[model samples]
Target: MDNLRRRHITSFQNGVLEPIVFDDKRKSMKSILLSSIKLQKTIAPVLSTIRNFYNKYYNTIHPLCFTFLSFLTRFYLISLSDVVMWDESHFGKFASHYLNREFYFDVHPPLGKMIVALAGWLAGYDGSFDFESATRYPEDLNYTFMRIFMASFGVLMVPLAYFTSIELGFSKHSTILVTLMVLFDTAYLCISRFILLDAMLLFFTLLTLFCMTKFHNQSYHPFSANWWKWLIMTGISIGCVSSVKWIGLFTTALVGLYTIEDLWNKLGDLSIPKIDYLKHWMARIICLIVLPILIYIGCFAIHFAILTHTGPGDEQMSSLFQAGLIGNDFAENPLEVAYGSRITLRNTGFGGGLLHSHVEEYPGGSGQQQVTCYHHEDFNNDWIVLKPREMEIYDNETDVEFVNDGDTIRLLHLATESNLHSHKIPAPLTRAHWEVSCYGNDTFGDEKDSWVIEVVDDVYKRTNHIRSLTTIMRLRHKVLGCYLRAANVGLPDWGFRQVEVTCDKRNNPKDTYTHWNIERHWNSKLPPGGKANYKSKFLREFWNLNVAMYYANNALVSDPDDNDILASKPRQWPILEVGLRLCSWTSDSIKFYLLGNPAVWWSGTASLMLFILTLFWYLVRRQRQYTDFSPGFLMDQFTASCSLKTKNMIFGIHYALIITIFWYFKDIAYGVSSPNIELKDKKWLSTWDIVD
Candidate 1:
């Protein structure tokens, strides 16, 4: 290459790949050392030859060696602590629920817990142990076996980092540094040693990234079998990561970005056949988009199939769905809705809640009793389907009237005796809808309290008469014509933090938010619906369950009154602003703190900032018509790879630095095994809440 072209190429390398074999930083470092330490100049060429030979032969061996060492590092003294730590209290309990085959709900998907349950089963655990925080395990529990099983995932992350880097065209030396950085990460090691989902989450995240890069490298092969294999694997990995936690969607988005770039490049290739381009598009649609969704659904299918008994999470699901649980007796609820029937109305929308009213009044809306959606079982959720106050008032002698389409009725708040009422005031959350509240005594409700029940559909019975737990219906205000809706947004703290309920102004017949189903019927004049009478399709339940998971996750706002000492904002994360206390601080118990190796974390941050600064300089120079990079840094990819010795030294130094830092903090990751430690030594930062 010409002098000018090499300078332009070297300029870009100085910004990005400066640590690679072919940069001037190595020469400068060597010169500084030689002048200060009086090193012989002839040693340079010999050192270069050694690095060249090692790079050519040892690239494959390095990742395997590091992976073996990582396994040792991660699994060493893995069962040092018998007490539960951090999220293990929650997630370990979930794994036990899975082992017991009981249905439960969580804000996250079920795959991680299921995987942990498999490990527990293998360890001969009978799901009888309590995973209370900082509580010691019983002698019979094989918690050691379980911890080692989960730590293997963390160990594999070392080789994954290497393979991911190599697939992305990183140099062999850089790959070694990357592998060591992950291998000795104190935080990663500590998390994997416990019974938590984070280790599984990270393993799948790296797997997703590695699969994406492998697929990218195969872009040249288009529809070859290997290409197809990797594309499908990428989708499967994405599904795995997402199933571990919804945060995996960020990984999916990254893969999506790469797919878009690949397709765009293929689109611009004039020589490739248009049919072949279309094939590429169709393949991506099938493997990347459709395959991931199928995998996600498959996980839920497995989740539903195993958890067959009623659990704490039954209320988070629909009443009909809960009825299918082995222990739930609600399946025997009476089928038909009649006058004087007590029931809970469930909103039919995805992630919907039970129609509820409490004595607390809406501060900004109608000032009547607050009507909201309750996710839990509460007496306030119960309402009576009764005759409008003036029409056919409920009396012992009055003939029973089954509610049907077009029947005008009033829903009496069974706890408070207030009728469900709607008015012209704006809703608390959704401005486009009217406020729905309970008003007037059961004997005095007027036209505003009247609702015309319109049956939408029925699962088993197609009659116009409403049925409990099956008939889907909408409640249209008799006077204002607004449909009752369980708004997805939640009310503020003063309203008890329940989901907002409103009367939607639009006549959107397809709006499921406005749809309601009678649940937990208490009518005595009818026969039991029978468990055999109620059934649930997994697909419908799957979507509804996932939506409920999403809504529950979004509803988790930080409680203002909760002095969450262990939690830190994202801004405090990178610079080691705080470290979490993983277990109890009692003097007799062992302790663990989740803190990353400062050497790796701070350097990565510095590297990222340096890249941003260099890119800005290049852009500003280019706009001034500077010939410094006439043909641009695109040519840097073709620059020669030489001067290997300096890269080898840098890689060695970085690897050693990571390991040394980890050793210094080994007590924190491996647990402070001895009791009664000093507070100053444990607390590395002012923000850390570690106790003596």
Candidate 2:
């Protein structure tokens, strides 16, 4: 190539008289200038052809080819590592529950699991896999069906991202870049191939952003059916996104902001009538908030309907609530309440448990029998309600006496045959009051063991009975002048890790910690039809389930225990400082690791940071340029400067970052501040990269 260039230069010199050009410097400069112009004219066509070719390939063919390759890679060997990885155990079991029409509880909403179940059902999964942790999947289980279902979402993400970039006004090269980033992300791939909810969440979130981008690009054509389609699709996608995980709310928020900005732009348009603002408001309200909520509720309703038979999740709900489900023991016939009834008491307090006693004595102080509140049901949970004074059986009359509010009673533990007694001893945990324990002789009680029943004010006017499903009451220790409080804190090992029971001096009637309700009652007078009305039962059960879920989610503690060295933090995510162990072979020869690819993740982080800086820069420049602006006028100026497409993309990036951070905190225990640790050794980590 060099020799050819030299030959061409010599021929050009021979043709143009090189000696004259060298001899006269002033003429040589002018001659050189003219030759340069002639050379540019000759090369312009070639450069333009090269530019056109680059644009054609990068803009037209690149994303298409990349998306095909992404799908191929995601679908290939996706089921090679045939084992339950990380959370697959939990989600797989949830899928099994849905297939069997059996109810189960989980921290997340049911849409993702329902999808998994639907895929499995379609692919011939018999709901036989136990989905236990570290267990090898049976050969007959429909693992590939569920995995392919999840991977499909991942495969779809590439094209969705590509179109979203185009909608955002990105060049062909930029769109290709976006497609490649999502296509090759290792963490995303790993999550997609597994039976987990995160893949579904990502899919719906991307779909939501893509639909919103479409809507934004078509905002000028509001009267068009395409705009309405995109708007409704955006709302439905939001519902699906949020149904998979609450982290999806971030995407919903971005859509909302886009709608607001779109309306604001309309308000700024002097050509449009002011009354048109009302139309925009009505359109957005119907499409964004109202439609999404309906779809969201519809998802839950479908979930409840499909999981008709009772299963493991029943224990989390109330006994009365469970009595309404088709397959629960309480659904058919419930007994009436009567005095001296053998019953089970349940507290409605947060993390509150049933009053229970066992043969084990207290750990150290006072060494009396251990009495505590347990969340789970056990034989020891049963108790007998007896009046303060022992009554002889009136052999002549067979009518049973009913217990009531303000009735003084003595609760005798059914298992240990000890009275539910309170004394002056300090509580093991809540030290401000007296300790509660079962401390009386068998089938006998002392005055100190007496408790005065005070039904919660709402039910106080009515007579108290064991069959009163809505009853709430408190037990006041007659001798201690205090209320029996089921302190939410757990006791040490001696108490079997049950919640501590204490006697509090403050007799607050409304204190949930001291409230107890009768759950199971035994009497012969009740009819057979009972309270098993499926529709109302489902509603009440759903409400209670939501309440419990809300409480449990908010009450989650983020402080890791001493043994939780593998816990991750939100801040560590951006730096790729940690990885989750997905699965490992029992022989230690193979493993799967869940971590993001450095090339994809770090570049994305950098790009997002650049986006943030660009946004700030744009805002500052806009503010400085537009000085004489009203509040609405300034917003109008801002919207005009940043087109809706660009604004949606920016907001989408922001939402992605926010959701990632939100999920990190929600899933991982991230309350503690810890020093950032770099991955100093990059040795054999790829051995666990199942995709490789």
Candidate maximizing TM-score = 1
For model 1, give the 10-residue run with minimal summed lDDT: 631-640
lDDT of 1 by residue, 1-692 (tens): 23322222333554674432354666678889878665456677789998997878786668768888988988888888877777877887888899999888899988888989998999998988769877788898888988888888898888899888888777655666677778888888888888888888999999999988888788788789889999999999998998889999999999889888878987898999999989988998998889988888889999999999999888777778888999988887887788888999999886678999989898876688999998877999999888876775656644567888789988999999999999999998898889999998877768899999998877775987888887889999999999999866878998788899999989999998999998888877777888887887788789889888877887787887899876578877788788888887677678788888888888777766766666777789989986453321221222224456755665677778988988888888887756645645756677776663
lDDT of 2: 0.72
Instruction: Give me the candidate number with maximum lDDT.
Output: 1
RMSD of 2: 10.2
Give the number of colliding residue pairs in candidate 2: 0
Q: What tens digits encode model 2's per-residue C-alpha lDDT throughout 1-692?
A: 32222211233454683422123455668999999999999999999998899776765676678678767867867666676777889988998899899878876777888998888888788898999877888988878888888888888888888889888876443565567667766677777887888878998999999999898888788758998999889989998998888789999998878777778888889988767778778888888899988877777889888877788886676656566667765534344456656778877776567788899887755678887888787899998877765545334346777777787888888888888888888888888888888877655667888898887833223544534445678889887789988857888776777888889999787787888877666545444336633123446556666667777777665666644534777887887776765654233323555677665666667766766665677678788894443322122334456766886675466446534533443211111112112121332344322222
Clash counts for all predictions: 0, 0
CA lDDT, candidate 1, residue 478: 92
Task: State how far residue 61 of model 2 sits from its true place (Å).
Answer: 5.7
